[model samples]
Target: MAVRGAGRVRSEVLSKKLYCASSTPPPHARHFADNQCQSMESFFTRFKNVLVLVAILLAQTIGLAVQVRRPVESGAPDSSKVTLIRYWAVSVVSPFERFFHGIGYTFRHGWSNYVDLRHTRQENHDLQDQIARLRLEQASFAEDAMQGHRLQAMLDFQQHYVSTTVAAQVIGTSGNDLSRVIYIDKGSKDGLKTDQAVITPDGIVGKIRDVFPHTSQVLLINDQTSGAGVLLATTRIRAILRGSTTGQILINNLTPDNRIKPGEQVLSSGGDQVYPRGLAVGTIESIKIDPDHQPYTLIQLRPAANLNQLEEVLVITGTQTTLSAQAQKDLAAGVTTAEAQAAAKQIADQQAAEAAARSAAQIVADRLPSIHEGEDEAKPGTAAPPATTPPVSVVPKPLPTIHSDRYSPGATPSASDLKPGAAEPPNEKDLN
Candidate 1:
């Protein structure tokens, strides 16, 4: 009974305390509750964004795992197994990748093309320059070849003539066709003198008129005051070649009976002593009767040399004495006076023998009787004439003996001396 009574009492006291606490009690407890609620709201506001990101990542991871774990059905296409996530990702990124790739490829292609074009243009320009240089070189080589040919011709001419000559370059001209004069670089200092013959390899050009220290004036063949003695090649007709006021070469003192024809070559006759004999002057261009001078023919000539375009020339300084001097020296050294005298005597004896033999052969041929064809062929039925012996007075002449001191065993008879019914001429064999 006592324990029960105590318990009840204690219970009543506790119940009274609980009721008071529930009713709202201390100031410290109420302030603590408000602070806890404010702290919880501030924490939620700061962590909301982080929580949302974490939720999205978790969702992706779960979806990938589900796809990986999904079972494939038999006989299904491989496309069915591809997840929409992968398809969406490829579709969304492919356009941007392609756009950037196209831009890069276009830039690379354009840059390469531009570089190639630039290089090609530079190469083309270089090739053109090289071609131009080659053309210039070709022209230079051609000119050199022509000059060499001209020099070769001049050299040949010099060697053939064996005359002393001085080479000169045409420096100036009269500048008018009427004067027909030219100046050469050579002058008196170079052994040029007045009346010296001037010529080119092709033909005679002119003669030196005035000589200066460093230059000489040449009177061309076509000058009015110029004259040369010329002869026609075929007819050997001699005439005076003179120049007219109009720079034409004219042959004067030729009558119509001279038979001058176009295209006939004319040559120097050496009558004037200025030009060498047989030097080419010109070819006959035309022939016409002179109107001013009756009975005389006017003959025009085309010059052998290119007189209007003279470039180089040769001046004859002296006559052809080199060959003659060489011959004289050789003769003096190789033959004695006695040997020459002996040779001359032998030559005279041989000539006498030849002349005697010719006279005897002529006499024998004239004395021999010749029968006519008509007499030998008498009437067919008639008898032929009987042969008769010549009289003793018509005896054949004896051939003259050739007395050659130095007879050669290989001597042969001359074809010109052999005649019908004539005795053979004496040869060196017969003399020996």
Candidate 2:
């Protein structure tokens, strides 16, 4: 009785551990023990059920053999049994097929895999597009930063020059044909006006030829009829610079008193109130003079601005010149009627010269002497006397006559006087 009581206690303890997970009173332990006994009873019940199924199979062996033999012996009639077997087989197979099909393990597996690959590819492409856009944004930011630096440099330059300045970008340009002009964003609204000086980092670029409300047109230093007073940087000698239509700006009529030389630097002489003094014009490329006018030089200035390549400029304001219509709003700033008429006449004359050149070419090809014309067109350094002029006798002047500045006295040589065989003329250069 004691051994049986100990077994009962251990069983109660196990039941309490499984059901309550804590200490339990004796009365509840009795109920949990009852549940465990009932569970054991149900497990034995399932084992008996399996034994009963084996017994039934053993009893039906003869009947099942008969059922199978009927189908093997004849291919006819017993349709009910065949139908029953087919239904059973289909029921079992259909469940397995449906389950495996849900798993996608059979026919469309390759197509499903292909779809997955394409989806992944599209995602990768989207990611790449995002990266490319980010790169472009970075490049744009770098460009903006560089443009800001350039603008700051321009501002610093404005503070250095002698003017109340309006800095402008060279936004638009006419082609190399017709006339050389660039459009600036500053106009009459920004205190810019016609005849205002346009300068770049290097030196003079042009002048304000036209002014609108928000923009202005600049005539480049290369434009015909544009003139400035320039002096040699080496000698302080002064000369008038005039732009020719053929891209050559000549310093004309610098008299016997003022001498210009080759390879001398030239700058503004401060003679005019328009442009400030000491703005670079250009270095003298070459000087030509005639012995008949032995003291003056004919200088041709190449534009210092490189007008073909300027990108930014400062429009000088408040240096003693202002526009006529500063207070007139909504008005067109333009040249006078007389100036317009003169410009039209100049254009007409250019056209006429072009036509005459075409006619002259025709004449030269027909009957004129090409050889004689070539001699007449020779450069000053290499020119030879033409056979057309007679050999005239000349009396020699005295050696080294000095009391100069006496003959022409402040009168400069003209372009015609710059033919050839001239003495080294007085150079319009400053004393370095």
TM-score of 1: 0.39
Lowest summed lDDT window (length 10), candidate 1: 72-81
Please give the distance, in angstroms, between residue 192's alpha carbon in candidate 2 and its true position after superposition: 0.8
Name the lDDT value of residue 335 in candidate 1. Answer: 41
C-alpha TM-score for every candidate? 0.39, 0.35
Best-fitting candidate, scored by lDDT: 1
**How accurate locally, in lDDT, is each candidate?**
0.72, 0.63
| Candidate 1 stretches greater than 4 Å from native | 1-162, 321-432
Can you write out model 2's per-residue Cα lDDT over 136-221, one digit (the tens) per residue?
A: 45444544544554676677632123536788866566555456667665667888877777887688877776665556668776
Candidate 1 per-residue lDDT over residues 1-432, each given as its tens digit: 999999998996676456445647368776675555446545766798998899999998986675553464211112333524433543454445446645765786898777547578788899999976765555445445445546867776432233688998776676677678787777778888888889998999999876665667788989887889998999999999988898888986888865667999999988887888789999999999889887888999999998888878999998862245654454343344435555788999999998788677656654654334344446667875563433324434333336542233225555676688987666554566
